[model samples]
Target chain A: MRDRTRRLVFLALLVAMATALHVVEGMLPLPLPIPGAKLGLANIITLLAIYLYGFRDGLTVALMRVVLGSLISGMFLSPGFMLGLSGAACCTLVMALLLKYTNCFSMIGVSLAGAVGHNLGQLLAACLLLQSGAIIYYLPVLLIAGLPTGFITGFLLNSLLVHDRKSGILRDLVRT
Target chain B: MTRADKILLAGLLLISLLSVAVLYGRFSIFPAKAEPVQAVITAQGKLVRKIYLTEGVNSSLVIQGRVGPATVEVDGTRIRMMGAPCTGQVCVKEGWIGRPGQTIVCMPGEILIRIEGAAPVDAVTR
Candidate 1:
């Protein structure tokens, strides 16, 4: 029972961390000229949760981050929220599947796939809302942008994983 | 680091390059023809008016939106927001748009100006 409570608390902390990242990322001016393009810095926490805990927990964290982030940012129930939710859902699903089904790809490959999935999902939402397929033209630009951002997050995750393995800090927390 | 990772990376790189090439081709080879057709204005999610965009013709409208009055100006083949009560003035800053699917929205004023039947582009940059 204590272990369960601890795990819940830890998950809540992760959710909070992810929310902060999301909100902070929103504040930063995007270097790219494209509207709605972002580095997706908050995805780091999602990848961490997936790698350490599991898919269910990772998905929960992603969903919580999106909802809480939007609410705090005062964009709840808006088109931006819808896009963020859809993107988060697609990213989490693809990353989870990649991690679960294949050992050939590492964290980097999975993260890249998640980034692509996120863009595709957002484009889908935009197309539906605008009632036009012309948004697909943005796909190539989005995919190109996703590459570097995804690589950065994946690299960060890999380093964190390495450190955690050596220190056993995260493992201890999960076990307790 | 793994074989699969290398292959995936290469594939993504190839796709990105190809997309860039396609975009370049579309822009340089066949520039978007600016054939202004008609402009549609909406306020508070309701269609307010539609005006045809023809050369040597100019029109202006003052629309009472949810927040306040917004002035839209249509000159020849281009349309723009001349003035709006919204604080941001982003709509006005959008300048002129004569292409279809391009939109200038003033969220605070709840006004939307969209051009229709212009060159069919994949999407508007802004």
Candidate 2:
């Protein structure tokens, strides 16, 4: 019972931070000239959850963040919310599969795969919503932009994991 | 980054370059024609309204977007998004588009404004 409560608290903390990052990311204008392209900073926490607690918890965190963030932003049940849902679903699934199935993939490989999956998923949703096949042409630009953004998020998560290992704060609080 | 990661990144870059090359070829083969006559607004891929731009007349138009109403301005032959309900404001930032084939898309609001239909050639031009 005690351990379960601790786990719930930890998950809540992660969800809160992830939601904040999602909202904050939406507010900032991306330096990249491409419309709708972002660094996806909230994904770092999702990756952490996957690495620590596992894919199920990671999925939970990603979905909860999207729902709460969109609701807070007054975008609930909108096209943007749909895009977020598809992106997060694809991203988390790809990262989890890469980590679990592949030996050669470290965090970087997983992150890159997640980024690609995210763009493809969101574009698919956008195409469906707008009923425009022409949007496929934008895929190349999004894929190119994903390279750097994915690497940065992955790199940050890796460094954080290293720090967490030494500090053991999270380790003591949550049972994996 | 692993050796496979480097290889994967390189491969993705190559694919993107190839796609861009193909897209460029397609674009060059069929250039975007100019001299649009009407601004067509669509929400969630469904036609909402079409406003023909009259000569020397200015007007404001609105369409129901996902979040709220998206406002657009039409002036003579030019059209631009005046205010947007979407957070990105990408549609508003697209500025004025006076030619056919230009579009302002607000993905968040599920709104797409496209300038289409070429201006008719008068007797002298014909």
lDDT of 2 by residue, A1-176 (tens): 88788778898999999999999998887776776578988999898888778889999999999999999999999887998899899999999888788878667778888998898888889899879766777888988898889988988887777788899877877765
TM-score of each: 0.70, 0.67
Displacement of residue A163 (Cα, Å) in model 1 is: 0.8
Docking class of 2: acceptable
Which regions of candidate 1 fall more than 4 Å away from where they truly are? B22-126
lDDT of each: 0.86, 0.84
Looking at model 1 chain B, report the run of 10 residues with the lowest lDDT sum. Answer: B27-36
- lDDT by residue for model 1 (A42-160), tens: 89899888877789999999999999999999999888888889899999999999998899987788888899889888889988988987677788888988888888787787788
DockQ of each: 0.35, 0.25
The TM-scores that each candidate's chain B achieves against the reference are: 0.66, 0.62
Q: Write the per-residue lDDT of candidate 2 for residues B1-126, one digit (tens) a residue.
A: 789888877887788787777665665533545554788889988998887766898988887888999898889878898998778888899999877677989898898888887644343310
